[model samples]
Target chain A: MTGPGQMLRRPLNPYLAALVSAVVLIGTLALAIEQRAAILRDGREILLKTEPVDPRDLMRGDYVRLGYTDLSSIDETLVTGPWPDRDTTIPVWLTLAPGEDGAFVARSASFSRPETVAAEEVVLKSLPVRVTVAQPSGGLNAIGRLEFGIERYYVPEGEGLEIEKAQNQGRTTVAVRISPDGAPQIARLMIDGETLYEEPLY
Target chain B: MLRRYLSRELDQWTRSGLLAPGQAQVLLADHDRRYTGFSLSAVLAVLAAVLFGAAVIALIAANWEVIPRATRVIALLILLMAGLAAAAVAVRRGAPWVAEAALVFTLLCYGAGIALVAQMYHLSGDETGFMLTWAVGALVVSFAFASAMAAAGAGLLGFGYLLAVQDLFSGSGTNPQDLSSYATVLALAFAVGVAAWRSRSAIAGHLSALLLISWVMWVIFETTELEPGYVLAALGAVAFGAGSFTPSPLTGTISRHGAVSAYGAVMLLSGLGLIQVSLVDPGLGVEMALAAFILVVSVAVLAVAGGENRLVRRFAYFAFACETLYVVGETLGSLLGSFGFLFLGGVALAVMAFAVTKIEKRFKKGEARP
Candidate 1:
């Protein structure tokens, strides 16, 4: 008995097969490069103070795990949107403003992107956080933990320890580029307010 | 291996007057001529491709700073194009095995390209996203070449995505309401199945089925209202019925190269075992009733498909023996001392073994009649 796949089988030209596969392969890589470059090209810059935890990834090699001080824990009173009933990850938009130490801190957060923003303040989108508990009045009892896409800074092999040491000394900061849509790209790494590694726009 | 075994057996049969003298040589030659597609060179080519791809991935993971990032990217692109060109040449020359190896190599290079791009930019995307992207690329390659190897790769990557997103290994419960996440996985699994069908690759088909089963297990892990044991048992019964009792043509198609009945029997027995585990300490009447039901199911499975399937027969014997010991231990262990329980358990297993041997003899006789 012939199956459906057997019925549909027809010989394709080898050159055409190769061409189609190559297009998919190259197109995926090109799209990834262009997306990252666009964010770095026309995005607002913000300096964030972070603490680093070291972990090794098999695919991306050794890296410094960055935890933002101001954005990691936001007060429940600052949240201005309805919270989900169940524990599930949802995207959050945070408005950042300069604090006393000249580093950006989250001033207000919302489930949806805010339309209006002050000139001095920048809105950055968090990846998602599992909201554990919610209040009856459309607020969260606990916002759980939040992360931006700029959480991990990949370093060369055996060089993560140097950044980890600097972070331990409270001297490490990250420069992030925020696109108009609240997406952020890591632009540079700094120690003691001095630029350590600047990202290329490739 | 089959050819050599046939040769030895034919020579003995000829000597014993079971066959004519020249028949062995003719049969051996025919077998050799009919099965010439598999070649050692093709296997070696695929192995070499895999080794080369792994080396490229390791180079990317090393974050090698000696060469500039853009230069490395360009080199990878060149290698990918070269692989595709090789595949085209092989296909044009009608060397299908070489074409398949080349396609596999190109897919691996594409995955390495994703990892390299992510590392170059320090993109903090989760592993699930990375695996999904790689899997999508593999699916495209599979469709383009109708390559079984690429389809199998996609199946594996889809399984990896499920593991990354769900707490399968960690045992941490995921939210049951996250059906949308599982929907994406189901779609990937379906694509893999279609790819396997297009390639007519039995290995890919098995992998696709296993992926779907893993997805079902993930769902079972998340939801608590339905008991997993019962669900597995019910599904297994349906699968077994479809494989063993379906009218011809469909039954022949499903069981042609794989034993669906064996897998079904396994799931059924596992479910029964879980039900036993959940018993904890039930009333004597309930315990006896559950034990009787398990024994009956084992015997029924043996009676249904045990003659034709060796795996099912073995599972039946195993379940029967285990249940005998459990009943003996539960009923007689307390009344008798530890030594007495061990003696009785040994005796019970010995009796079950004897019965199984008799059953095997009957099955052999039944087969011999045909």
Candidate 2:
């Protein structure tokens, strides 16, 4: 399309390129903020019992790792479907209802989504995880453990160890906000029924 | 870069009488008019932008409790917007180097914002997820700006993501998201590769290649169920085969200058060497076979693309030297001891020197004829 005297190729319009760059970056920030805000505003609140653990993140600061008691293991008795023989990671649908102690616990776990959600029940989607079910006599009933992504509670610097100590004493609880899509985010950390830290959605 | 190439060619043309001296100066002037030569100040401006970006990330990590979270988030967004707006102005003013640097700064701000926001909100996802998000954002900026620097940024981000994934998987329990993480890393690599090709950035392309190779190595290292050496050797073979035989689509639209094939050959040879080292009770025959394979591939690479591809030539030379020494040690060491091995190595080097001289002559003759 060009003679030897002309340029080899047409250059992209710099103005348009710059404009698109700005818009893309702005859109990314907006999307992140919007998602967090929506979860903070409209998600349902649920309290989870936590055990003791601690870790540090360079960028996210210090944190106490939260492992829920009931959610830790969906025992072979809790699994509602046929367990596969080979080791595998699969998505689990957990049906949650208030337990005798007033803390939400897994009522039924299934490979497929439950067909119904009762008015008082909440079904949360768990991240795909390796099901450590022992294939004993029959495959009809198998119990295993599953961990959702809501595990860590990031606290301010030098505060993680105290929370971990409280958690070890069975005095720590996590307040989570479950979005409509079954995604749960840690909303607050409570020890001995006193609110120690409340996460702000920025 | 274009100016350097044109000036060299112009000198030859003027000396050969293909261009009058007056005409040569006119052509040189015209080229100079169209292209901006390298400027130290412009480089400093970009360097400053990078430093600024790093400072912003460091500031976020510092966790300034004095500033409210809402204010920090708003400030980050505003900084990103301001950087982009300045870039747009630079573009309109016909300063592309400045614009690219500004875009890089903006992408950095966006990444810092993501990390800080995640920290503020107590998001519990792994570092892999954070890096993937950052890489994707950098890739978006790269594509939108058509900036090779931004493309290089994307490539670097993808590499960081792979390293994070390796860290995430190196711990005790099996990673349930292993497959997904690998897929995401590969996809990120491909995206950066695309950006590199689009921008004709060789450095970015090479970085993408490094990411792919590292991902394969990490996967092989994580699961010992599969032999790392054989898997890497097979992967290298496939990559080299695709790069050498399948021309158009396999090579994509990039002018790689046989770089992919060169990288594949390095992987192949390195894997074979690893196998030889890991062989516990191998007979002399197996060791001899590995030595032969390494020698043949290195020689073939040197012969085929040695003149055109500098990377291939250098790696080939190094591999050939190492394989020769290894073979010598295995065979002659037991008989003649270490001194004899050194003597044989010296002789082998002489032979290599002779062969290199002959090849150089042939290449020069071929160039002269053409």
Candidate 3:
């Protein structure tokens, strides 16, 4: 420990250490960049959001206040069973017909697959959106690691900083996609999403 | 023709005598049995583990409350013990899956307890008990198993606890009375955490840092009540001290988080202190001494910022910048302040040049550290 400063770094290597360090640093940087990119890409989810639910999480603070994409104008009658409430993050199958808005209105939702639908049932991804610590109060709107049939929750930093803040502050707003069957899947958080700070009433 | 052809082939094979099928067939069968048996079982074992994992999650969610609090705690401890046993068995028997399963369950249970508390208490301001429990439990598990994840979790839990209890530390009135006491507690916490860190236990550093930082901030916030000026004086010294210890991430980070507030307060207090000194208030000598001490700290900070650590240098540079800004703003605000601006500007520019030159020197030195 030449200067007491060297004491900290004595455990690491010397000559090839920089190369190893660079790899480690770059790998971490890439992940961070990827996380930020994910939030930036899906920024539009802010506009599509509809429902708000509170989830008690430690990393992201006390609750997961969230909203979902609004399908208010979609058909309500074709729906089947209850949606995932505060209970589960289960898959909710749905079939939607093209509405006047050009968006597929959800025709039905169920735990089991629908046998037939007048309109083609487009299989949509139901993801559990979470407020990552890195981008607390924001979302990395990227095409997640999993494209469909999976939810993506990002870890903001090596240790969750922003998420902890939000959890402590109760400012992290997460959005979930609720199928007509009442089953809910996490969509995205309101952290970086273009939405107001408040929880959506619906 | 068929008889002749068969006879010729039979004669050739009999002559070769190397066309025996039974030995090769038996060897192939034995190999198949060896490879297929283990591979199939491995696949099945993984599938079974996944199913069990799913069931564990389901059970926790379904009967979250049916399992008593005490039972969950005991189960977590048992699971941790089981995980260690499994790891040991795996190491001994060469069965990696067994150990992996045990570890996963222990980790999950350790994490789940905190989540359960948050759920049980509705996780509002009133959920302090839950936070404390999670933090403590996580700390125990982390140290017991030397698990980094658990330690980090504990650290986060500790931070959450401080935030939840900020009211107690925030203090009331204008005097920051509890600083010395709070600092002592933080120091003790840091000592314990360091021991844990040295042991390579999870969450030790995190927990230690979380406590230390929150305590420092709380102390600053609390102490500001007595005389907001002391915070700047103390924090500025540390920031400068940080600059002195360049290329250290710990020091760098500490300076940023701790000294940022200190620097802000320094500028405000220094300007105000200068004005008070000029006025010659009866007890102004004490204030003047404090101001001089602060100036020494700033000079030290400049020297430290001369180091290679980006965080340290940035903070030191920011401190200097803030100091200059404070002098300029304060002088402009006061009638005589304008007259001293020229002198201050010269000193500030000189400091900046010195810092720039040190940058090259610092980088060269940095290249040598391991």
Model 3 chain A is weakest, by summed lDDT over 10 consecutive residues, at A141-150
Q: What are the lDDT figures for the candidates, one per model?
A: 0.82, 0.76, 0.44
Error of 3 at B19 (Å): 60
TM-score of each: 0.87, 0.82, 0.35
lDDT of 2: 0.76
Off by over 4 Å in 3: A1-202, B1-108, B114-126, B168-188, B200-207, B216-224, B235-299, B304-311, B322-359, B362-370
lDDT (10s digit) by residue, model 1, range B109-195: 998999988888887756777898999989888887888788899999998888877742233235443666788888888889988
- How many residue pairs collide in each prediction? 0, 3, 55
Off by over 4 Å in 2: A1-12, A54-61, A73-76, A116-120, A132-147, A200-202, B1-19, B23-43, B160-187, B209-257, B260-264, B278-280, B334-343
Each prediction's interface RMSD? 3.1, 4.3, 19.5
Better of 1 and 2 by DockQ: 1
Docking class of 3: incorrect
lDDT of 2 at A102: 69
After best superposition, candidate 2 residue A53: deviation in angstroms? 1.4
Best by DockQ: 1
CA lDDT, candidate 2, residue B315: 81
Candidates 1 onward: DockQ, in order: 0.52, 0.32, 0.01
The numbered model that scores best in lDDT is 1
Task: Give the per-residue lDDT digits (tens) of candidate 1, residues A129-196.
Answer: 66656545575467767777677788877887778778877789988999989988889999999999
Q: TM-scores for chain A, candidates in order?
A: 0.86, 0.80, 0.30
